[model samples]
Target: MKNKPNQLKYLKYQKNRNKGFSCRRNFLIFGNYGLKSINSGFLNFKQIEAARKTLVHNLGKNNKILIRIFPDKVLTKKPLEVRMGKGKGAIHDWVAVIKPGIIIFEVKYKDYDIIKKAFFCASQKLSIKTEICYE
Candidate 1:
């Protein structure tokens, strides 16, 4: 079955900069490579899962990959031909409201080249722009 969130507390949010790079107290505390978001947008769980799968499949089990963001915010939608007067919509999917400078993924390994290759595959799965950062 396709992945879907079982429940969500709310449907809409304030779209404020409530979280960002400043909140990550240990952004570089564990990884050598960080996947930083260059744009702000909602990232679906499926997209993150696909990117993570690509990283693990290419990098194998020796290295460690950490997913920093999560798809917690609920995004609702209506049917294609539905009437316009309905109340908002039902919960259709879940996503993470990513902001600029937020680290989406962190990779830790000894080989920089391998890290770059793995990140390259993963980066293609995202919709918004991203940048590779190292420490």
Candidate 2:
């Protein structure tokens, strides 16, 4: 599924300088288990989709999966060997600015071992380190 915002107030945003730990979405809310990020980074849409697919493939269809993060920030890139002083580059990708202690994915399942394994596989597809958390 596409995870980008349909409309944004600003087309491009400034570089992300917010390094503070995420205060919101740090706790499990919708599910019994979750994958919490350990480091701060930008998660692109492809990585997010890969992780989601891995989770779904490992967990099967009966389980419920909730994606906590969305790629709202736009990343731009200049064409190869482009001249300087050409303003901002065109939008190349979308990413989610993630911070430490943020819950990236949540799952509601009865089996702990299965959930752990699925989360492990999903974490492997992500760019940041993640630990499985349960409530």
For model 2, the local distance difference test gives 0.92
State each model's CA lDDT, in order.
0.79, 0.92
Model number with the top TM-score: 2
**Shift of residue 28 alpha carbon in model 2, Å:** 0.6
Error of 2 at 44 (Å): 1.1
Q: Candidate 1's residue-wise lDDT over 22-97, tens digit each?
A: 3452356578888888777888988999999999998897778888877877767778999889577777787887
For model 1, the stretches where C-alpha displacement exceeds 4 angstroms are 1-26
What lDDT, from 0 to 1, does candidate 1 have?
Answer: 0.79
Which ten-residue region of model 2 has the weakest summed lDDT? 13-22
